[model samples]
Target chain A: MNASDVVTVASSVLLVLGSLLTLIAAIGVTRFPDLLARMHAATKPQVLGLVLMMTGLALSLGDSQLGWKLTLVVLFQLITAPVSAHMVGRAGYRTGKVRSDLLVVDELTEDLRAAREETDREQAGR
Target chain B: MRVSGSRKWLEKIPMVLWLTVLWVLFWGDLSLANVLAGALIGLFVMTVMPMPRIGFEGRVSFIGTAILLGKFAVDVLLASVQVARQALRFGHDPHGAVIRVPLRSHSDLYLTLTAVLCSLVPGSIIVEAHRLSGTLYVHVLDVPAAGGIAKAKADVLAQERRVLYALATDADIAEAGLPPRPWKRGRTDGPDPTTAVGPSGPAGDDQAVTR
Candidate 1:
């Protein structure tokens, strides 16, 4: 086989694997019990899938300019995915979307309680 | 005061150069004309919308950054499979928990980087971050599988330590109460197994039985 044929085969494999990962991530989002859990599904495999697919595309194209663009796509996703996930998780926690009964241990609730009590005590002293 | 003013401008150069490179990349052609246009646009955007200055007091370590990125790629791969398994295991339910981890570093840059890294890693997400206390509240998809609360907390601390080595000054490392990074020694000891166990049970407890 020629060099181009090998590149084509490798790219095809990567593309298939990446798509499978994305499908699993979607399944995870649907099956997961809570908002926070769902966000994990949305961010993790989804980001990795994008990276893999981008790599495949870059290889198949074999153009430096297109490769740079593909690199940008992965870089932007890596930077933004976590920020979006954090925002969603934080919002879910504040809006009572998180199921406390499902959790084994919750230190955030305990710390929030302590903080509130401290504030209340300070106000009472004043 | 004048020296500090120039230093602030110097700090902005990297931001501008990054923007310029992004602009050129988006344009798809690397030429003198494209670079000049990108630089011009980058300058325009910077002046039009100034961002809050994020002080970076530490120098970058090439070895530390390589280690950080290399380990991160591995973590993402392993965790993605783990989460995928949890999803596919039809009869099983993943026990989730929100555990607070107090980080040693107080710098905004380190804290933000740590939080971002933690969230992107598959099984964990940052539900809340208490800036004053330098604590991150992370929600883990499967606590027992992740080795437990103590293990999860240690992972986060380990991440923060890597971040410090990648960017924080030696003085900052000392301030955070961590020993000097052994860059030349490489591949330090693994997490202490005794401390890795959860409070309620031994770390080896089965997934269903633990919770």
Candidate 2:
């Protein structure tokens, strides 16, 4: 097969893989037994899947400029995805939405409780 | 000096550099036009997305997270069939159990994701969560057996493993000192209509599994 044909085949493979991975995450978002588990499935799949799929498309684009733009969009996503996840997670935890019984041990419990107690003590002392 | 929260973005310089490199690779050319454009876009985004002041954990690995996604998919497909069948068969007061699951997650993000995934499945729902105990209370729509006391517990543990199995660092899950889905044979003093001695005694494991 010619170089372009080979590239096309490779890109197709990547696209399929990426699509499948993304579907799993989406299903995970749907089927995971709870919120904590679902989060793992959702964010990671989305960001990585998009990057892979975008990579394939970029290769197929046949233009350095358009490829760069697509790459830029992917780059922007990689940066922002975690930040957005962080924000949502914090809100979920603070709001008491994440289930914790599945956890075997909680490393953050002591520090978080201590800080909360300290804040309450300060308020009471005031 | 009180750390100016504004300067926190400086800490992200490394991430920005990494992102810029990705842009270049994806674009496949280091030509001036692409270079300038990528730089401009990265800088503009960085300037706009204000980082939160947080007692943050360590970095997130895209590769590790991707692996977690694969595991979640397998679990979901399996769970869907389980839930759908339960919904269709033996309709009355389908026994359900709500059990608390806890995990030693590095960040709240991980914890929330776990909860969201579980709730999406047809049978399970997360009703309450406490970050203090890191406890999540979930109500399953179907019980494992008429006397589903065993299934109740198993459901909780099974879901727990599926979720934590994906994201928990090996050390974290192990250190978390979690449990396997041991049948609550003895501790099951609770009402289990699915019990072998119960009216549904002739039921197979599949029927015996649901509440």
Candidate 3:
């Protein structure tokens, strides 16, 4: 096959795969047990799906200007996805919405316990 | 080396170049006029909003960076498949855990990179990062056994080593207590792996029960 034909095949494949991954991510968000797991479903496939979609578009368009713009989209998504996930997870933990049954190890709770005990000791000493 | 005097401007070159490239992309052109305008705008933004200096003391190793990128790409693909399989299966028990991984590197840049990398992968998401102690609280799906906790900590340490080799300075390496060369085969022992005190019961039991 010719180069253009190869590009067309690759782009089509990427678009299909990207959409599928994004669909799975959506299902995961709804189906996952806890907030943390939902966050995993929310961030991972979404970012990768976006990256794949952008890659497909960049390949098919073959325009330098458009390619750079697509790159910009991917870059911004990569930078923001984790930061937003971090914030949501932290918020969920603070609000006690996170399912502790789902978690295997939770050091933050221990830290909080220690802090509370320290405060109690200080008050008793005073 | 301390950034002071005119040399401080040199340090900002990477940011300026990145901003200029972003501007060019936004404008959808790479003409001489666009380039000049983009650079000018970049300079204006940098001067108007001075960023906090988070001492980025690291040198890029081209080969190391390339390897890390390749590994990251592979990890993303593999983890996607794993997560997808778990999501697709019917009545599969979702055993997620939040384990604490103490990092060797104290650098904020390293911690940020580690968190970003972990979150990007499908199974694990960094819930919280303690800046003072350099510990990452990662929520990972499917911890079949307690050994999984150790494996997770090891994976984070391996990632840190790759990042250290790719961009950390000699002093940063020393401060992180890493060898001059990246550790091979997960040989570099990390700090104690702290297990999560998960709420009693399997995650599947709580699947439909919402807070």
Candidate 4:
């Protein structure tokens, strides 16, 4: 009814939504078939869910200092999430954990093959 | 040449301001004393650390930037809903695929930005990036057909065009083989679609779909 009450309701809605999204992300991690798909589940929803939760907390607190702190959390998450995913994906690929069949297109393998051929030709020339 | 030196220092102001704000937030206070201390710490950090020089070779178009941001926000919402649907599906195997996208821009900044943006969206994540060829290997959910692969590549190119419009130099634009203006829809002048390849079928060793 009041302004403060409206803020409270909105914040509460955001918190619930954030929590649900995170729960879905967890379910996705367990349910997804391969490492690549699992990485998708682990990063996407988790980062967005955290952002939503942070935003909700910022709104509820109503303090500018706390708001900026929450913003910092979101910023760092955004920066780090993709980098970490890239690392894990690369590791999985190198370790042969990724299903080659699941890959609809694989340019990396072709590139590697080409490089290997070039080196083989150079060795033969010697 | 005289103003260039001062301009470089001026450019660092935004980074310093951001650092100061971060410091204030870390301390959990907005008092005058905290603000002063934060400023001092920010100055110290800036002096101690040699920050990477950001390429701001092009003019900033505020309207273009706003449009890109708006598009990104909509994409995030839509992609999240789509992923959530797939996530909650009961007793259904996920048909995900990794697709390779050949980008037009060779710039490291562009490649990095594109990867981050794609990963931020729910359905796609960049697994490997080839810097030499400016290609990205993206793992995507539900690529049922060849057309689906095309659609994914198109989405990434569209995002790149938006980014170029917002903050790309003329040289960057030329490198990407785009016109000075925003890329027109259905423009066949861009990179050839044939370069973008998806597997016709399972390559080798088709294992059971593990869930």
Chain B alone, TM-score, model 3: 0.80
Which DockQ values do the candidates obtain, in the order shown? Answer: 0.71, 0.07, 0.60, 0.51
Model 2 agreement with the true structure over A4-103: per-residue lDDT tens digits: 9999998898799779767766765676554554554566556556767888887877777777778777767755655555456556656867555543
lDDT agreement with native, every candidate = 0.83, 0.55, 0.78, 0.76
Candidate 2: list runs displaced more than 4 Å: A118-126, B1-211
What tens-digit string does per-residue lDDT give for candidate 2 at B1-211? 3554544545556557765776677777787876777777777777787455333222232344455567555655556445434333432333444454555554464556666655544345555556666666555544553235455445555555555544343345556565421232354466444323322232222222111
TM-score of chain A of 3: 0.93
Error of model 4, residue A71, in angstroms: 1.7
User: What's the residue-level lDDT of B125 in candidate 1?
Assistant: 92
Residue-wise lDDT of candidate 3 within A22-48, one digit each (tens)?
Answer: 999999888988888777777888878
Clashing pairs in 4: A104-B199
Ranking by DockQ: 1, 3, 4, 2
Error of 1 at A15 (Å): 1.1
What is the CA-based DockQ of model 1?
A: 0.71
How does residue B144 of candidate 1 score in lDDT?
86
* Best-matching candidate per TM-score: 1
After best superposition, candidate 4 residue A41: deviation in angstroms? 0.7
* TM-score for chain B of all predictions: 0.84, 0.51, 0.80, 0.73
> Best lDDT goes to which candidate?
1
Comparison by DockQ, 1 against 2, better one: 1
User: Candidate 3 docking category?
Assistant: medium
Question: What residue pairs are clashing in model 3?
Answer: A100-B199, A104-B97, A104-B196, A105-B195, A105-B196, A106-B196
Instruction: Give the candidates in order of lDDT, highest first.
Output: 1, 3, 4, 2
